[model samples]
Target: MSPTTLPDGATLRTARPGDEPGILHLIHALAVYEREPDAVENTTDALTRSLFGPDPQVFTHIVERGGEIVGIAMWFVTYSTWTGRHGIWLEDLFVDEAQRGRGYGRALIAALAALCVERDYSRLEWTVLDWNAPSIAFYRSLGAIPMDEWTTQRLTGTELETLAATADGGGRDV
Candidate 1:
């Protein structure tokens, strides 16, 4: 796909192989922005493996201005049974602190939404932390409403394995 221009003149495009390092930098910045600097568990090698591997499950779009990556949107596709269609589940949306309020964040989201429409996806969705008032407000202003009726659930690490083992006919070998 060709480059798309953001409101502030930044260019947005799909990430490529060499962009992994830049994407990792943004991921680290995002972790710090979210007040969990130590939570970034993926290294450059890991990011490259998952994002550029043969069977990449996640995707990203990078926004750059003046030869530097200032923002990124990381996401994956999900299916909505009721809608009978696939939708985008945005995992991360980050704009460098120095670039905030320049329309980068909104541009990233809008770009993704456009992709959803282009690909015939049902919708684009993501969750914002309850304490992130700024982000919550920004999302609300974009007409993205909260799923107040639903609660997100997740199981990771050993818990996930343990839960899966239950279906192995009481075998904990896994």
Candidate 2:
């Protein structure tokens, strides 16, 4: 595959159906970077379906260098009640260790932010592990502020199913 070149030889482009394997690889790399290598329970099949299924819910951009995928940024839109507008939620942003010093991270974030501006999204948000200093610095450099006033809550696994089953008037499942 001929490498598409960005200004510094780092090309950023929307992922294609043929890039499933590359995307999975980048996801694994990201898991490793986050110190949760064993937490990547997702399969290529799951990723393939999630991104390109009949009803696609996520979008991704792959960063290529020398004709090889070196990084990825996956994102989706969410509604913010306070802003009353659609916002971009960056699900994952990962760059290979070898490619870290380059401008891929900045490129990816800029691309997402530009998309938000062009599409009139009220905000762009993503989370970083509290201990990830380098990432925190990068985000800060881009003028992102920590939402210290709010905390993230999640319901997953059996809890999610149980909650859904009893959402309306406390069903029998509750």
Q: What is candidate 2's lDDT per residue for 1-174, written digit by digit as tens?
A: 223466786788888887888888888988888889888887878888888899989989889887788989999999989888898999999998898978888888888888899889999999999999999999999899999888899999999998798778687642
* C-alpha TM-scores of all predictions: 0.92, 0.90
lDDT of 1 by residue, 19-103 (tens): 8788889999989888999998888888888889999999888998898888999999999999999999999999999989898
Candidates in order: C-alpha RMSD to true structure: 2.7, 3.1
The per-residue C-alpha lDDT of model 2 at residue 124 equals: 90
lDDT of each structure? 0.90, 0.86
By TM-score, how accurate is candidate 2? Answer: 0.90
Report residue 22 deviation for candidate 2 (angstroms): 1.2
What's the CA error at residue 151 for candidate 2, in Å? 1.1
Best by lDDT: 1
Model 2 CA deviation exceeding 4 Å by range: 1-4, 171-174
> What is the lDDT, from 0 to 100, of the residue 116 in candidate 1?
93
